[model samples]
Target: MSPPPPDRLARWLCHPHFFKVVLLLALVISAPTVAIGFYADDYVLLSYLAGRIPGSPPWYDLYNFFDGDALKLQANLVSGFPWWTDPGLKLHLVRPLASALFTLEHAVFGHAPLGYHLVSIALYVALVAAAGRLFLRVLPGATGALALFLFAVCDNHLHPVGWIACQHLLLAALPAVLGLLAYLRYREEGWRPGRYLGPLGLGVGLLGGEAALGGAAYWIAYQLAGPVPPGRAAGLRARAAAALPALGLLAYFAAYKAVGGGAANTGGYVDPLASPLRFAAAAAERLPVLLGDALVSMPADLTSALPSGPFVAVGLAAVAGLALLYRACLPAIPERERAALRWLVPGALLALVTSLGGFPGSRLLLLPSLGIAPLLAVVILRGLRRGPSPGRAAWPRRAGAGLLAAVHVAIAPLLFLAATASSADIARKLEGVARTAELGAPPRERAFIAAASDPMVTIYPQAILGLASPDALPCWSALSMARASHRLTRTGPSSFTLEPLGRTMLTGAFETLYRAPSAPIPRGYQVTQCGATIRVAEVEDGKPSRLEVDLGAPLEDPGLALLSWRDGRLRRMALPAIGEAVELPWSPGPIGLL
Candidate 1:
């Protein structure tokens, strides 16, 4: 059997009208989001809007919700933060454009979630279209079309599109992509308007979110590696002019710091400007994981699920193997495609660096995927065409390419489809948990969650309740966030100690989300919240080994109720009597897998 002619094959692979397909795929994949109501930070945003969570900024300034000290006071009052939360924890962000959008949506839609989901879907579709346009500009023909297709169906879009709070990711991406497209036009077509429009678009993107910094990386990459104009002086001038857009990043950073907008005292987020070394360390640790995710189909979210040492090691190995595989296959790639690779590879890596401020997740891959999609498309297309041909000398490269193609082309789409459904289902489950908490807890009684596998189950329910009925908001404390079996020993009439059977508290990835390594809780440290005092009883390896909780009431008090997550459900559990010990089994609740 003979392969089809080159032109025929190219025709089959390329779609000149790929944007339409991208739009359709975006719509189809994101349709399930309409069923997903408020989850995680969406509840917090809504609660703030409802005036339930005090100290939050006005609607337009809502992105600065974590900036004020008043919120910390409010958190202490209601046990909003976990017991392990850093005393000076700050998760401030400057995103006026995204905040304004949220404000506008809430004013118009109020509590009806259908409107928010629709807006998020619309933004996502726009972002996909923008990305397709950018790809077509940089990588023409079959490669560009394939890149658009790969990006359109990428599972990374699931979170940004489905989760309302994550709309900022979409908002940031859309303008950033447009800016890159404009910059490309300036470099490739000599468009005068593009020089100004490119910088303008990036500036607007910065207003959307800090994720916009990734766009500046592409600008830098183009200046460094993109094709130069005919005259040497003219090319230098053009490249120098391209630096204007990157200035937006500097300006954004300056303004952000001026306004006291940045995350601090949290292991989950590292501020690059404030703590450069720590940020570099985090980026170094996270970059490989993100690279593995982009190069192959290794889910970036696994960083949270698995131990850091093993996960980072495996990710680093995958990155090294993929780099070598790409190097082996590079000679087979056309010079034009290889030229694109020079910029694409660097742009993708730099974009990934921009996202390392937060924990690695599929959601953060959106910006990097812009460059990776095209790079992968070119490699995969060339590999498929040449690797399987008879008399190929590079059998090793062929096998490596074949494996890459199998994972990305065959398996990735199925994972995307599954992720689309899974994202919606996770939101539904979280909402269910919030609803259960609202109904199960008595109006006046304080609730204590004995054990919850996921932090979302513990933190967000109170905010959800505040949104639903602020007047009757219940105070609840999550005793344990670890997904491990524990031995609950009753120490006194009003105090109980929880010791994990095999692990120390606040050591897991999710557990560390609330506490930074720099602000470790001392053994005798105590936090009083909602009539209960939580004390760090014992420490092991710099982590809490035993946590003693003083309920301020007898275990048999009818005013207090104990709840434990079991079999994916939050159910009331019997309190251990004084001098009694009870075993608490680990259960991955609805959002645990996420």
Candidate 2:
């Protein structure tokens, strides 16, 4: 009998011939990441490598604008800790392999951003290609094909691909991917070829990074998922062998943490000895979100800003594609493969929950996809087939699957566009900060870098060094200034007090005071180099507000100007000096050139 329309359509779409097209699209979609500049934590990496962080000059009370009063960055420096004794570095979490890769890149590429982007893309592309092939091997027929396509296209969790600091996820995940592949081979080809390779992959993955360790659960899940052998003794032996990797990983983590091995434990982990309940609660809460982000394309971080019209299109497409592909792919999967998901599901859950002691970001989701991807494939197959012997899928079920699949397929491309836009946005902002530094920064030691154009709450390196160089580096950054933001005004104009927040000195050539005001100030309240501040009352809320009040003599006569930093471009307010009022009648405050 001729196959039904949906089944025929699925076969064509899931064909192996189409995989090359998906691979090509993956490359194209990810290429724009080259445009992204080094941002935030990327600078932290540079700072540490330069040895500026570990050995900050005694004179610097609080180093850099990014390092607040606490000297948190200074503490995480890997220099002081001996690896054999104390594995943890104060400033960073320990991921030796990932760190080594970044160091190697820097040695080769230096400050060039494009080189790092390319390297990451190359590695990720290879990983994706492997994933697609692996899916084809395990699941039967078109199910594997469809799953491979899904693996290639779906990259909503792409932090590792874009961010320099997040490459650990990719590094750790690669080994796990290898392990899964080797396990599949072992299941098919028996002892000699697959036995040693599978466990070796898993064990290496454990030491590579914490994300790598999540694969143990996947190993367990894979072994027990299918039909069991006739002998209980055989099953027990198989399970025991599978358990070795997980046990080794546990032993490694215990030893690593005991000596204070550096780990990415920001709010995610508390010392079990110190507070077990807190750790347990955090893991419990994070488990659901982690699974949700992996299986569902509904992560709030990336999607909140998405336009409604496109989102609806994405949603409708997913519903339709999933519906159609589910029917096409389901029957093809062997019953044994379907059982594999039982282990895959729990493995993914355990991997995420156990790995993070604190909150997990979507960037960390890439590793979990190893187990989740296979599990999701199994789910898709089961939902479509519905039973041991299947007839034509119901209309409602087909429609549902098609829509879901379409959303997944469509969103991948859309997310690629969004990531590109985000990278461009970061570059643009970095440029604006650079411009501001060129015009205003002084060739001096200390600088008061009030965060005038902050997209997020914390100050970034872009605000301080203009995204390049430490005093030690060959090239000096914009303004060639070491920026500090001593606490400034809060509340209203009356409550405003311009003074150093902590012990950190604002004694450089310029003491810039940045402010984001609630209400508009009357004329002459603050200086603006750009225009008359009298009408500065026209300034709106949540906008960047800067007033340049020149210090004629220490706290004496003041000259005024206004600076507006918007749209990743800056307009310097160079209004010739009007006498300064140290206190404003509610001025956004004066920002002086150092």
- Candidate number achieving the greatest lDDT relative to the actual structure: 1
lDDT of all predictions: 0.77, 0.49
Native-referenced Cα lDDT, model 2? 0.49
Candidate 1 residue runs with Cα over 4 Å from true position: 5-9, 68-71, 74-79, 232-245, 387-389, 392-394, 438-442
Model 1: per-residue Cα lDDT at residue 172: 84
Residue 502 in candidate 2, Cα distance off native in Å: 24
Clashes of each: 0, 49
lDDT of 1 by residue, 153-259 (tens): 77766788888998888888888889778877876788878877888888888888988888888889878777765553446676677565576567777888888
TM-score of predicted structure 2: 0.67
Give the C-alpha miss distance for residue 213 in model 1, angstroms.
Answer: 0.4
Q: Model 1: clashing residue pairs?
A: none
Model 1, residue 85: what's the lDDT? 70
TM-score of each: 0.93, 0.67
